[model samples]
Target: MGFWDFLKPRSKEHVEACWPGGKMLQVHMEYDTEKTIFTYFGRFGLTFNISKSQLTGAIVKEISRTHSVLQVYSGVDCVGTTDILPTEACNIMKDWLGQY
Candidate 1:
């Protein structure tokens, strides 16, 4: 990502991770009809974009009906971890695999 990219708007969405805490996390991927590429946004401050091939999607382990552990892997290593919506996790994985 470049500095000027910050000033520009791309295809994306903002997912509210915690509304009460005022913490927002974008674990969802929005479809870009123009580019036909799914973009993942969540990283605050500095946004980083890597090769789509590097992503292995997310592993969602359910802890309860409403909770799950979401771990995103880039290659063999985990790039991110958090407990969010399992359904959402599945959607993210689908995007990572370019199935959506």
Candidate 2:
């Protein structure tokens, strides 16, 4: 490893969730000290970045605790929602965002 490696942002982190009917959803996240890029798959295949400024006001809602439906919102727009494991949701909301 090079000395500057420490200054570099972390590599992308990937997580996937599968539904009963063979439907699968995956999230790829790349986070730096300043911002994070979130990529979603399955139904809505789109990728977007959320900076510190936006993350400060971002909202993550647990629509169904039992079903593990988590909704993410930026300002008034509904970015998207996913059905993932409860643990995954917690990690994203707490661990990931907490780093900033």
Candidate 3:
């Protein structure tokens, strides 16, 4: 399965009860060579990273406990130049959010 598949939207009633104008995001990381999705509440200043995978990225929106997926934006490969790669998008998200 691809990433961002583990998260599910929360109930409408619950979302309506919370603050308005808040965005949502979900994240999934590889652990023991297996993917593990984890939901977290985040605003515009959250980030996380993984050294082994050499990934990084930031939360572009607010998320809820029901969020458990991530939409890749940018990333980099451990080999070759240090330039950002699509693979490192997840890492960038985590680093900016300090979720490492």
Candidate 4:
């Protein structure tokens, strides 16, 4: 198996291993609608947008989206990048895990 393939499942397993205190979250970005929504436990939900940055806070706790917009926010550093948007999803995920 490829390195990425091996790493992917191992990482996911690590996440799963940290459940209850942790969660499997789904973050959805609708390209057609320009909306972002988060789903948890396949039911609980929350949503966000670039315009509503204040309520979400300076650091996001987690994100699990299917779109590349998450990539656009990932690893970005600038007032324009972070002030208007939360930090990268991966950054949030790492922070969450470290809390454990």
Name the candidate that leads on lDDT.
Answer: 1
Q: Which stretches of candidate 3 lie over 4 Å from their true place?
A: 1-30, 33-54, 62-70, 76-99
TM-score of 3: 0.19
Order of candidate numbers by TM-score, starting with the best? 1, 2, 3, 4
What tens-digit string does per-residue lDDT give for candidate 4 at 1-100? 3435424632222122212222334432221112222112212333333332322323332333421112223234321111112234435433433342
Superior candidate under lDDT, 2 versus 4: 2
For candidate 2, the per-residue lDDT at 83 reads: 41
Question: Who is ahead in TM-score, 1 or 3?
Answer: 1
* Model 2 per-residue lDDT at 94: 40
Q: Candidate 3 on 1-100: residue-level lDDT in tens?
A: 2355337553333111111122332322322223322223233324343333344443333243333234332364222121122344434435533543
Across 8-63, the per-residue lDDT of candidate 1 in tens digits comes to 97433532122211234444444444444434444454222334456666567777
**Full-model lDDT, candidate 3:** 0.32
Worst 10 residues of 1 by lDDT: 14-23
Question: lDDT of model 4 at residue 86?
Answer: 29
Those runs of model 4 whose alpha carbons end farther than 4 Å from true positions after fitting are 1-24, 28-43, 51-100
The C-alpha TM-scores of every prediction are 0.44, 0.41, 0.19, 0.19
Give the higher-lDDT candidate: 2 or 3: 2
Q: Could you arrange the candidates by lDDT from highest to lowest?
A: 1, 2, 3, 4
lDDT, each prediction: 0.49, 0.45, 0.32, 0.28
**Model 2 agreement with the true structure over 80-100: per-residue lDDT tens digits:** 554454545534544444554
